[model samples]
Target: MTKKNKKDIFSSKNLNKNPSEKNTYNIDHVLDSVFGKEGTKKRELNRKKAMVLFRAEDLINERKESGLTQQEIADKLGKDKTYISKIENGKVTPSVDLFYRYVQAIGKRVEIV
Candidate 1:
């Protein structure tokens, strides 16, 4: 029934750190701690990978909403079910053209904002 400050919500409470210590934790801090600093190679790579995973999840939801199965999408794209599965699982990154094909195959369209 009380509001927690952002630091209190994101601090190292699970790590057994002293609650009295000043906590500067936020999303950026957590990302830097887990994936290295922004602009570093590790962080940059992780950022790209994260984007790919997000897009994959979006495609998955869109396909489900459209009432299409992975095999059906694969049929539309002339690919095997495993290929679509790989993309959804983040084991594959489709090219821009292929990504657009995926969106269209699921009865969706891409719009630039």
Candidate 2:
């Protein structure tokens, strides 16, 4: 067997470069192509929607992990089950304060930096 050169193995040319630089579809490129560029109204709107959906999914996962149901969380928050359902379904985006309450209700804590 031949001796291996660590430098050669760790060379920049041997490293995985960014996919967009290789003319591949990175998420930014795909989003820009499909939803217009960042700062544009369409892209901004979509970005906000995506963030809400992500938070909604995270809340759902957290609730499930805490072994709690929507009704339980709703009870903790003194809200209706449908309210939690709406938030988790991404049909509603709660304000920051409400979102913090939801997180707390799910037995998770978020510290604002």
Candidate 3:
């Protein structure tokens, strides 16, 4: 058997595209070509993350409004104050159940929209 040439290995035809043009690797272009531009992969991911951040911020504000110290809130949630701080600071993502417990500890109701 003979050794393959470097050019043969690096050629676009050997890979995934046409050798003649530039390919735009933007999320929109990729999704449009693969799944369709109407695909919600990017938007859905961002929206879900934004919602979690919004919920965390709301919980922090509510806790402040209720005049409860972080330690107090932590005690109510059966967690450490550091954990409460992490949630409030957006250092960690809380589960739906934990979010509800946080809101309740802050003397507020968790409303899902």
Off by over 4 Å in 3: 1-38, 111-113
**Better structure of 1 and 3 per TM-score:** 1
lDDT of 3 by residue, 1-113 (tens): 12455455445554555446678223343334334346468556656677878867877788889999999988998999999989987779888899888888777885569
The lDDT ranking, best first, is 1, 2, 3
For all predicted structures, in order, the TM-scores are: 0.72, 0.68, 0.53
For residues 49-91, what per-residue lDDT tens digits would candidate 1 score against the true structure? 8998998898899999999999999999999999999999899
Where does the lowest 10-residue lDDT sum fall in candidate 1? 1-10
- The count of backbone overlaps in candidate 2 is 0
Q: Which stretches of candidate 1 lie over 4 Å from their true place?
A: 1-29
Lowest lDDT 10-mer window, candidate 2?
1-10
lDDT of each: 0.82, 0.80, 0.72
Best candidate (score: TM-score): 1
Q: Any residue pairs clashing in model 1, and if so which?
A: none
Order candidates by TM-score, high to low: 1, 2, 3
lDDT score at residue 17, model 1, on the 0-100 scale: 49
